[model samples]
Target chain A: MSRLDDALREALRREEPPEGFAGRVMARIEARKERAGAWDGLMAAWRGPRLRWAGALAGAVLLIGTAAYQETQRAEGEQAKRQVMLALRITGAKLDLARARIQRVGYGLGDR
Target chain B: MRIAIVVLAATLGTAWAQDIKMPPAFDKLAAKAEESVDVTLDSGMLQLGGKFLSDKDADEAKAKKLIGGLKGIYVRSFEFAKEGEYSAADVDALRSQLQPPVWSRVVGVTSKKGGEITEVYFKTSNGAQIGGLVVIDAEPKELTVVSISGAISPEDLADLGGQFGIPKVELPKSKGKEAK
Candidate 1:
């Protein structure tokens, strides 16, 4: 292997990210939770009902909107696909015409 | 009656708006191949664009017959099955190809929804634009490229719609075994 290939292989061989990576990540998450504290937890509980209701309503709206949008997109995509196909057909026809012209040119040259 | 008229008007408007348009033709000769690549070449740094392949392929003769009139080939593609399947380093490899005196950066547009990055480049010949390139790093579900070459007109590109052998509009009653 070339130097670049060797280097790439070496890099690939060292698959492990780093030592204590998971521990460090967990510790950071725990620290954040501690800083958030009991008051934060209490507030979350108090707002839980309202938040659930709001989330449900938002989800319903989002689902409906997404369905409508997806339908429109599907229709548009179909239309565009059709257009592209048509374009290719037309282009193909033009190529046939050009080939005929070239053949005519060849024939003319032969006659000379 | 008023509602019906309003609906009809809206439908007509939409149809008009969606009408396929073509660009103006110049003295330049752009061949019509079975597969077309619309490339915008500025300089040595090439930015590959778009490709249209013919649906039918029987043999080399047929393929050549279909592609004989084509002028250029353009391809914008990406390979990714899952999230984070590709990394910055992979993109950097592509970017590295466009580095320095050959190509200069113009714009980089990243879309979080599709997890794609489109970087546009200008080919420099003594700091002049002789070509253009766009690299799109996209997920399997979302990838697209638009390439043009040889004095291409935007209008022609738009009109290119419906010229290829795309399926035709069929009514529900006519839908038979072919529908599947």
Candidate 2:
């Protein structure tokens, strides 16, 4: 542990680069940056004009689909309500007719 | 999903042990008719409709009350392009479904003016309460059949009259008097 500490302190001491050492180090850094693969280079590329528009279109489609789906459900509910009303209307009309007949029968039976 | 919930409620809440299924023979008539309306609202549909019915709306309230104890409502109506598109055999087939001891035709009105015939049948359980009713309105160019299965009565039906496009009913004098 003492040896490691001594090495770290020695390395940490103020140091000056040899004659063109700074230039060499910078050149190495530039070369390493160039070696970064095409995938990484493409990833860092500027977003194209159509990319944002495509994202917006996809978002719009998703929104419309959600709205349409909900609208369809609502429409179905409304249609169900309409059918119920129609069914009741028919029922009421028919029942009224039958009731009228029964009434006539009743009056006849009573007079008899 | 919402429909599923109502359907489930119908299965549990309504007293109907079984929903009256429409006969397959009726399918053949659908293709021949110019316009057909086939509505089958089981206990679930009724119960679901009952939920949206407002006491403030007289027709809805009346319909709601009328269907409260109902198990199902089935209506099959067809309008043909011409007369005699259907025959008595078809009528007899439907009438046969109403066999004896259960359904009795309380009224059959034949109108010469419109060449229309309307037959009404009722299923009586006790002496007073009617359990179900069927209506068949046959016109020269149209046919309408309605079946209501549930615990019902003439008075219960009378309750729906005077509104909802149902003409003012002239209830029987003696019995109507007692009913009120």
Candidate 3:
């Protein structure tokens, strides 16, 4: 029984801790906090200017694409307008010539 | 079978009455010409071009109004470096397509001295109304064929003769400048 009591005393006895144990624990906690802070900064950087740059790039591409389409349409429309004008000019010229000849014939003028 | 035949006949008859096909000889002439102007504008292209024509300009406005109901306009003008590059047979091929029963020669002017022949043919639709017009202007060194298909009136023809850069042709006052 006494042996048992002595073993209990030895097991439950309060003893002084080794030197710098609390400092080591505090240092470990500080290192963990620094690592967490650095990770948060990296995430914040990704969310800030990097996301904005991606959005801006997408918007620029859309704007350029729309402008190019409008330019193509304008060019084609202008070409068609030119063709129509040229056709009208040729038709008008020929018709005028025919009318002139008809008038000359009506006036008893021979084909000169 | 009878109904199908009737439908096909009607469609073909309508097409034949409205459009004049330029002969393949014109393509050969185009290849040989020094300078050629070939303009073919269908209904869709005309509509697109008409949208761009400004309402403010006088000529553009007139042109836009003129082409409002037009189905197509095809013009082929070829100018050779010299005379005799094209033969009379080429012109005959075009004239053959504009025969009677659907087409009638409205005006024909031939100048032997200047070696110029101009003929205008009108295609009739519904017996009286003009459905299309074709103009063949064959000069010594130039050949121009203008075919406009649509509902065109005599007033429209007069407008074409008067405006759109067609100088009001005045009778020669004792051979002054030969009417340009």
Question: How far does residue B42 in candidate 3 sit from its true spot (Å)?
Answer: 0.9
Q: What's the candidate order when arranged by decreasing lDDT?
A: 3, 2, 1
Docking class of 1: incorrect
**Each prediction's whole-model lDDT (CA):** 0.40, 0.72, 0.84
Backbone clashes in model 3, listed as residue pairs: none
lDDT of 2 by residue, B18-82 (tens): 43345576788889999999988888877766776778987777777888878888999889999
Candidate 2: C-alpha lDDT: 0.72
lDDT of 3 by residue, B38-99 (tens): 99999999998998998999778888988987899999999999999999999998898887
Query: Could you report the DockQ of all the candidates, in the order they appear?
Result: 0.03, 0.20, 0.30
Candidate 1 residue B109 C-alpha distance from true site, Å: 0.9
* CAPRI verdict (incorrect, acceptable, medium, high) for model 2: incorrect
Question: How close to the true structure is residue B137 of candidate 3, measured as C-alpha lDDT?
Answer: 93
Best by DockQ: 3
Off by over 4 Å in 1: A1-112, B1-76, B79-81, B112-114, B126-129, B140-180
